[model samples]
Target: MSIFPVYQDVVSIANLSKEQLPFFMRHVTVYKRKRLHHHDFAELALIVEGNGTELINGKPHELRPGTITFLLPHHIHELHTTESGPPLQVYNCLFDISLAVGPQSDPELSNLFMNSVEEFPAYTDLSGEAFEKMKRIYLELFHEYSGSSPGRNALIRAKLTEAIVLYIRSRPSFPVPGEKSLQPHPKDHFWEMIQYVHNHYMDDLDSTLLSEQFGVSASWIHRSFKKYLGQGFLQYIHTLRLRRASGLLIATDMGIHDVAVEVGFESYRTFSRIFKEMTGITPSEYRASYAKTMK
Candidate 1:
């Protein structure tokens, strides 16, 4: 028996040879969007202006401005716009990872890839200043791509490099608290509170304030931190403080008491005790050892 032929438009830029160009970008406008589809290439979609539901691996998320996603090969997904809602518009940038195979083989560049590619979340919300920075990059990329300027390839690579570097260095919205058995549903809220604490770790951080701000149960907040962060909330704060103190010890000539206060320790006595407990050495001893090593 003979089988009938089937057809699908592979996710590739038309008129482009894979051997020549590995990067492509386009502005997309859709009144009615396509169904879930898989692609062999990776994609980065920046929501320009649209309201819709994005289904990724069967989970749905409300997509709006400042929403960005990095799609991996074979990740099944699609978008659906509301009838009375806004139009579905986006800038979709596609690239072949094979283009960077040689660079990625080096340890330093591989580390860059790890942070920019492997460590990124599936989707991120970029708002306020972060969103503006992304918009600028997108605009520059578009302008350079559309113009037939000299050293075009080099400039395009520079734009992409800037974007990737920004992505890697941007502060993460969530916590990657090591590998452990997740406590269950509702426990994932650890990251939301974690971000807030990271921004205010130098201030007073307590379960009560976190619960009040996040609207979750105080016990749940504490439990989430304990399970996901592998430590209780207070312990996490102390860890951050000690980390800052260590940096100050090495990078500054600040006195021990000043370093303690700089890192938010209430008093030098409490700071010294915690520092010794965490590092197994007094703050002054750590500073002395570091100074000697630098010589």
Candidate 2:
């Protein structure tokens, strides 16, 4: 267990619907700051007023009206308000990656999440017409998120996608020092590979198989998995499988071995061992525990 706080969507965001939309939006006023923390979901904050400094991944960036900060999963960050100024006000938005980008998303837009953190700055300062455009988008997002209008989900997703695309467009095209340029980059196909794994995690997938399918080397696959996802190839696959298995255990009447095989585990024994190792419970125990809760 890590000492620092790691917020998850299901727990941190209120009224987050797993079956509906994995999105949350709110107007936040920060009178004081909290301890440094990271989250499992993606976040975008548009500073509407006040003065502060945002510390992202140990780097400080000035915060004021028209400043936009986008944080990916596991990017440690903290916000601090200047004593002389009023509380920092911002439209804070939290969402899952699936809400903004998907398998069919434009590669350039998908790169916003897939590209390495070192390749681009997390915060961007906006001014003039560009800032106003983004401000309107965030305001519209807040309205749609809070309203009972029909087609609300679709509109919210569209606005969120627009905000992300605009943010990406606002970034400089040139690469940072010692980093490869954005165009003609090596990680262009990385997002595609990630989507492929999501769509086929239940199959026999590995770095070698993905490498062949994506025309990238096995070493590159391993490195990208570590760099972008913060986990190794097999660990990532097991994570997906275990997540699906956990859901099935609670949501269905499938047998333990059947659930394991359904999630791509070839051996029941291996699935049980890994499930216990990762979740600290056997498959049968997990399902029974859920049943007990229901009762």
Best by TM-score: 2
Q: Compared with the true structure, what per-residue lDDT tens digits does model 1 show for residues 1-295?
A: 2111111123222323323345677888866665655443466778878888776544566678888876654455677887788788888766654433345434555466556545644666678888889889988887877787887767777777666556556637454443332222443444445546755777776888888888888888766667655677788778767765765576556789998887788899999999898889999998898677656
- Please provide, for model 2 over 1-295, each residue's C-alpha lDDT reduced to its tens digit, 9 standing for 90 to 100: 2223333433224543224566778798888774566554578989999988887654567889989988865455678898877999989888765555677556766766556234677778889999999999998999999998999988998899899888877877755453222222355455446547765788988888888898888998877777766778888789878876865676556788999998899999999999999999999998788677655
| TM-score between model 2 and native | 0.63
Q: How close is candidate 1 to the true structure, as a TM-score?
A: 0.51
TM-score per prediction, in order, is: 0.51, 0.63
Q: Which candidate wins on lDDT?
A: 2
What lDDT does the true structure give each of the candidates? 0.66, 0.74
The residue-level lDDT of candidate 2 at 195 comes to 47
Q: Which stretches of candidate 1 lie over 4 Å from their true place?
A: 1-12, 99-109, 115-120, 171-295
